[model samples]
Target chain A: MAKRLMPLLNRVLVEKIVPPAKTHAGILLPETSNKLDSGKVLAVGPGLRDKTGNHIPVAVKEGDTVLLPEYGGTTVKLGEKEYHLYRDEDIMGTLHD
Target chain B: MAKRLMPLLNRVLVEKIVPPAKTHAGILLPETSNKLDSGKVLAVGPGLRDKTGNHIPVAVKEGDTVLLPEYGGTTVKLGEKEYHLYRDEDIMGTLHD
Candidate 1:
């Protein structure tokens, strides 16, 4: 799948991580539900371009766990796999250990 | 509606601006559809926290048109209206004149 879409400048291709069937607060969420916040980095794009037209580096790398804004990103379905393409700015922050 | 949600910090209460039923490329979109990239700022939060814990100011004010990431933000249904509550980081950039 990574071979197919080349994420444009500063955009990252993310594969959302389905949270455990329950929340930290011990609430059971159904599979057909939406959390509004969840995902993991699948592939990251070259960072945004600086004024000099040079590529700035991205903070998060592939395999990093990250938080996404609930309602922002371009959704693309490759074959049967669903992925989201979004800019680095759309990422809130890296999840802490 | 603004009275209900305080928007926490650096978050904005966005009221999505439906595209004009058409795209710049002359594509018509339906109302029940989701664009993954459309919205107007209804109310803005104070701003992100500075190192000193002071409120950093937001770039865009209320009523400004902005682009939202497609799959980020917490969705809240207040009364009959649907609104997205997201952090300042979720906002991509302000629309230009």
Candidate 2:
């Protein structure tokens, strides 16, 4: 049996998306962006419980592309790939296309 | 009227306590501690709104001493004093005596 990761309490697991090195016009891309990083949501945790004990759903679901902050997140290594864990609120926004 | 800070959404306003340079026995003290900083709670936020807009009360109240993490907090300047703002959950613990 293969091990699986299940995030808890509104945490989201994401795999970063590496942008292409050059544009179609042959313009080189910067190594890093100080503002945001692109990633795909791998897993979503059950929503956090409010004071009243009601579950609050997370903002994004599995397979959603999201904008991530340049810094701050827990790094998790599963097998050979690297993943990041962030609070639902830390995910900036979802990509449309 | 003087300016007042009303923290919102489970934020806390605290004034850092500067420990004495030397112990009662005359041992010199270090400039900073990596573990925690002592602070007095000046104010507490109304509490973060859950998905359903329910209120969740903060853990500590004004005048209580608390343990603050070594880093990560918003600093605010009010009048001639400096204060720090932290999420209610970020506060480590309440200090006794």
Candidate 3:
């Protein structure tokens, strides 16, 4: 599914695709698993507001594999797909190989 | 317990104090409830490295009540208490009244 754009500062819109069914430990996991994984960055906001009221640039770009936190995102459904809209600060780190 | 400092970029050292017992829904939750809460900011890193290779300033200061992500922090025990050391990006927001 094509991703929609989010218009706001510090917000990111993500298409919640189901993660792979197994872990690196080779254990079978389900959708309800609390494990977090990396996802393709669909869309990002301009950035957070700096202390001086200027916009601080975002470190991440679209299409990066990012690690997200387990909670606090607002979940929404777009057509038949579930997506999350959260602040960029909620993103933990970029997954490196 | 006194908090120990973590030396690194983007890392925040927090004392993992147990959350308040009840939820807004009036349910009594335990420490394993998986509910995130606000904590007194003990120590924070200088900040993350920006795209330009410069140190970006941290938005949070010591003593701010911040919302932390549920997972991804490296747990450490200093003395008799368990604490977490994580990146500042894992912090969701500052808790305001």
Best by lDDT: 2
How well is each residue in A1-97 modelled by candidate 3, as lDDT tens digits? 5446564787777655466577678878655543444456778888775555655666567776665566778876767777777777666555444
Interface DockQ per candidate: 0.03, 0.03, 0.05
Q: Least lDDT summed over 10 consecutive residues: which range in candidate 1 chain B?
A: B1-10
What TM-score does chain A reach in every model?
0.76, 0.89, 0.73
Alpha-carbon runs more than 4 Å astray in model 1: A1-3, A23-35, B1-97
Per-residue CA lDDT of model 1 for B31-63, tens digit only, reads 767556667887765555444444477777888
The recovered share of true contacts, given per candidate in order, is 0.00, 0.02, 0.00
TM accuracy, model 1: 0.45
Instruction: Report the C-alpha lDDT of model 3 over B1-97, residue by residue, as the tens digit.
Output: 1124332457676666567688889888776765775566767765765554556766677777888887777654433455566677788888887
lDDT of 1 by residue, A18-90 (tens): 6578767887756545444556788887766555555556656788666566667999898889899878766
Alpha-carbon deviation at A35 in model 2, angstroms:
3.1
Ranking of models by lDDT: 2, 1, 3
Better of 1 and 2 by lDDT: 2
Among these predicted structures, which one has the highest DockQ? 3
In model 1, what is the error at residue A57, expressed in angstroms?
1.6
CA RMSD of each candidate after superposition: 13.2, 11.8, 11.8
Off by over 4 Å in 2: B1-97
Clashing pairs in 3: none
